[model samples]
Target: MDYDIAIVGGGPIGLAFARSLAGFGLKLAIIERQPLAALARPDYDGREIALSQRSVRILDDLGVRHLLPPGGVASLAAAHVLNGGAKRALVLDPARRRRELGKMVSNQDLRRALFEGVAGQDGLDWLVERDVEGIAFEPASAALSLNDGRTLRTPLVVAADGRLSQTRQAFGLGAEMNALGRSMLVVKVAHEHDHGQIATEWFDHGQTLALLPLQPRQSSFVLTLGDREIRELCALPPAALAAELERRSKRRWGSITLLSEPFRYPLVTTFAHRFVAPRAALIGDAAVGMHPVTAHGFNLGIQGQATLARQLAESARRGSDLGDLRPLRRYEQRHRLLCRPVFEATNHIVSLYTDERPHARALRGALLGLGARTRLPRTMIGTMLA
Candidate 1:
């Protein structure tokens, strides 16, 4: 085998996985289709990732946390959830001992940091601008044929590709997919009023909105609506879009203007039928795609990659075949336990908030009220976020 392990993506999660296994002296290769320049200088894609304390700690360990630009990591003091212009809200923050809930960082920064951390690492190869055409597994190794007419072998293969993973499908693994029939419109906006580091999730009639606080007078507006309506909103001129956002939030930010081009993404979620098969294991969005409402997708991916890497490292240390199914199953079991409840919960949250019926509205109001009064649910949510 040319490499001990081959990661079939070069995104943050994939780089982090390779980094985790590098300490074990395993030769690694990243099979990425993107050009190295794009991989190295990731553009701001109007997406921000909410990093949990655990994720931050993992990045810190990987030496990637230091790459964050000043003012890029925003402190989230608390998150408030309101239902249909309700006077009351469900407030969730960190535990009593913590001053902040968590941190938020731009996706571009995270990807750049992760790439820089591993770009010069030993025993790792960058197979950039290359696509995996086929993958075949033997008893001792997996052989991957690249589109460039080159082939490489690795004892184990890890899939960190996004939700629609070609690698996963090539392995004949199945996924339970959900097309939520909704889309989210996201844009960076400059506001006249400061957000005070408070994030707001408003479930208004026929709309679900989330304002993620950024530095001072900046925030990311995430508007969830039907596909057709969101397409129209995405097509709106910046001025009109800003006006709509300001009106949607009831002038919470006083007045707003677009800071970046708005982008629209179909809100889809996926859960792989299995996390591992034979010499391969899945991580990141490939294993389970979460609804962004919970904002745990990337964090969970980072943590899950660590889980599988530890098992792979141990197998390497023991001189066992790295593709041995034993460790793969263990990693799968652990990750499944960690992600199943959250996946179900995120789906429920999406379903509940997106329903516009009167009864559903009343139920949402009552649930918000109950959540505000209940300590357990709030604490559970806080624990998940932090």
Candidate 2:
């Protein structure tokens, strides 16, 4: 197969790229190992994603916003940050800024929306159940070899295969993984209380827990803890684990019951040494695996894909080779410049809040208090959501 762009990985990020490039007069093909039916299934329990206002704007521009399922999206109106025992609370109101803090939607819904949006778009092709075996870059084109002995040749290749991207490694642009020695236990639960579009995060000494409101009576809980603690939590019976979560959350939403089996994902920081190499470029987690505490991983991926699409479109319009080093460099520069600071700041925030030392705890409490009362810090946070 020959194409102008061949996108590896058909996850949300890759789908977003295809959607963004829908109207553009560029031939695009998305290759994925999973079939369309499998991708549409909601078997995975880790279904929630926090979508920032900026992310919403990007989806809106692609004409895929309305594809979101009914009652599957929740607007984040307020966020409350508590220190350990709930003695200190920092509340942020998105209404003050005249913009939603973010939106919460099921990961399945997001994938389905993006997939449907790209279905009939011109110059787009989705090749499912095609496992990539290798990628080779030539002087004029890049070729992807599939496990089935098929080859896809394109002028530009996008690696959105995720943190452990085979495409990235195949291109000799593997990332440096910095394990934070932590894992997140994620699950959905039925809350008795009306959370009313409120998202809450509690920072204890060893764990940072978030209760993100979903639809009418659902919420997703993410508990970040050390690997040992995660193992212990997972080993416990579902009832026991639910009890522990209720105790830790102070039963804020009344009695908590596990609605799904718990899952753990190792928390790590990964950065590709280079986002671009010859005829190839990396997007989303293939480029940067962000810490999930800031809830920016998927958001960053969406933005990264959007930026790449814009850059590629402009390059095509200017009669420049989309796969040229110069065009790829521009995409890399823009994404790195936008992602680096957020990455560093989120890492710092994790370190500070997870520290059990007396001084660190005191400082963290003070900072949280200041953030709640001061306009500057609040505005900075508002900008993140915006």
lDDT of 2: 0.85
How does each model score on lDDT?
0.89, 0.85
Tens-digit lDDT string for candidate 2 (1-386): 38989999988999899888876688998888888787665356585898988899998998999999867888887788888774757877664747568889988888888878888889887788898888878899888888889888888989999998988998899688898888999998887787888888888766788989987668898998889999889889989998999887778788888888888888878889999999899999999999887789999999999888988889878877878888789889999998999988988988899899999998988898888777765677677776
How many backbone overlaps does candidate 1 show? 0
Error of 2 at 372 (Å): 2.6
Which number leads on TM-score?
Answer: 1
Candidate 1 displacement at residue 302 in angstroms: 0.5
Clashing pairs in 1: none
- Segments in model 2 whose C-alpha atoms lie over 4 Å from true places: 95-99
Q: Residue by residue across 110-173, what tens digits does model 1's lDDT show?
A: 8988888888899988898999999998888889999999999888889999899999998889
Give the lowest summed-lDDT range of ten residues in model 1: 377-386
Q: In order, what is each prediction's RMSD in angstroms?
A: 1.2, 1.9
